[model samples]
Target: MPQSETGTDTAEPVTDHDAQAATDADTDGSSENGSVVPWTSITKPTDDTETLAAMTAASAAEPGADDMADASLPLDQVFAVLKNERRRRVLGMLKQTDDKLSLSDLAERIAALENDKPIEQLTSSERKCVYVGLYQCHLPKMDSMDVIEFNKSRGTVARAANTDAVYDYLETAAPGAEPDWYRYSTILSVGGAAALGTALLVDPMTPLPVIDGTVGCLVIVFVAYGLGAFVWTHRAD
Candidate 1:
């Protein structure tokens, strides 16, 4: 209205307005980018769900096992086999006196004589040494091509080198000797006989019906026989 000659009026300066608009836009952009703080400077939460779940999973996982282990079978036989070691040092120690070695003593001796260096370095070496003796020393030798005639029940023992042509044929056909079938059969037979004997003894003293005691004893005997048969015929693959 005042500068009518140019048909315009210079009401306000653009510099201040433009600067204010830029400052507001920058504030909004900074908020959009999360924050003005550097990435490394930000504080992470202590109880993140993903991290907690990962930690729990790791805690729950079972530890890995060592590969050099043998199948755990009859404890006494396994113990005997493991007792046969390089130079039979362990066996000799046991034979010097019929003393059962404590875990600590066994570990110390085995660590002193172990073939594997990593095994020797173990601080709690007893467990490892026992494992080696049982699996590596005993089982393989027992399973080998050599003919070993050992009585599990009587503790009778003998060994002979494989020279027979028929021995080769047997080994080739069976791979391993058909696992001590006679021993298992004998065990089952003894159990069955015992059950029958118990049933007879109890039947005389038992009350009302003869059928209950008879049937129970029969069940027990049958179960024992079944278990024995399974133990004998089954081979670990």
Candidate 2:
């Protein structure tokens, strides 16, 4: 009878040498050194390493880095330092003007512009009117906030609070803005009055009787003028 054709009996078995040869081939010749080098074990972070190195170099290259360590302040300080728009405009005008303007002169210029007349043609009264109005009205409020100073002798005044910083900020922020002298005059004048009031209140030199009599009279006059201004500005509105 013919031999049975079972598949298990016909299978071939591998020798030990063949198995060793197969292992060597699988390792790609690394097995000869008694250690197999892993093909995908560790990788160099070329892109990431280069980025980190670049950032470190950049930080080192910056000048005054140590000096600028305190550059940023808390939000409260930032808000406190910022000036209002009107004050900023006044500072800018003073910075750009070669001849510092007196309160009257500044107001005259504005009135002239509004009236469509030449600034040079404005009469003394027109100018003084602006000055008085501003001194008695606008300036006190601004002075209360410490935005400017009035020089009683020179008859000239200047920006008092954060003037430089405010101007610098405005130069970048509002390059096209021009000073509104009417507004400026008012603010400065009121500020001056406030200063006077403060001096009287603080210094004992101010005569108490004079304050109740002369100073009181002046205050009444100022209040009256201020009321007129309010009405005028109101009607115009």
Candidate 3:
């Protein structure tokens, strides 16, 4: 210790290592000394770090991720969701629109369809009946499965990524709009049987042999139509 003329002790200078040790001790996550350096200042994260992190979060938040998540839900669950005719009707209405609609508006329209009246003619009771079921049950359940994005607070309904799986099982056409395949098939069967019977009864020299190939062609058309219908209904699934 060096004493001053006034008999007070003078303080010694702090070495770089001592100051660094003080800093390192205060820092909770700084790295230790490297090969030649005694200590180094830790680099703080820049804005780029936050930017990259936000980018990663956005990518994970994409609709594709939600789609994949919904895909993991069992198909039986989806079928259960569709089991209710009201829910099916809800989905149908949503499928028709490209943008969000108010819950009140949706309920009113559905009520109109069910009541066979225009929306203007819908009674308060009719609207409330559909609205209550949708608000309390259907929309929440569908939203839970990620089938639709239901903003309960705002009362807005919008389509979501999971629509395809449920929609695939629905008849897109309006009631009675589709052709009567049963009737067509029946006519073909009657025609085919009569021609085959005629070919059998007529002489082989009377051009009746051509009926065999004609019946075969009709059979092929029937099979093709069946497969096409199957494929059409099950597509995009």
Number of the top TM-score candidate: 3
TM-score of 3: 0.45
Clashes of 1: 0
Clashes of each: 0, 10, 0
> Tens digit of lDDT per residue, candidate 3, span 111-199?
87767678998888999999999999989999998788999999998887677778877666677664555666678788878877776
Q: For model 3, which pairs clash?
A: none
Provide the clash count, candidate 2.
10
> How should the candidates be ordered by lDDT, best one leading?
3, 2, 1
By descending TM-score, how would the candidates be arranged?
3, 2, 1
Q: Residue by residue across 172-236, what tens digits does model 1's lDDT show?
A: 22323444545555776787667667776777787755556666776787687778667654432
lDDT of each: 0.48, 0.56, 0.78
Q: What is the lDDT of candidate 3?
A: 0.78
Instruction: Give me candidate 2's TM-score against the actual structure.
Output: 0.33
Q: Of the pair 1 and 2, which is ahead by TM-score?
A: 2
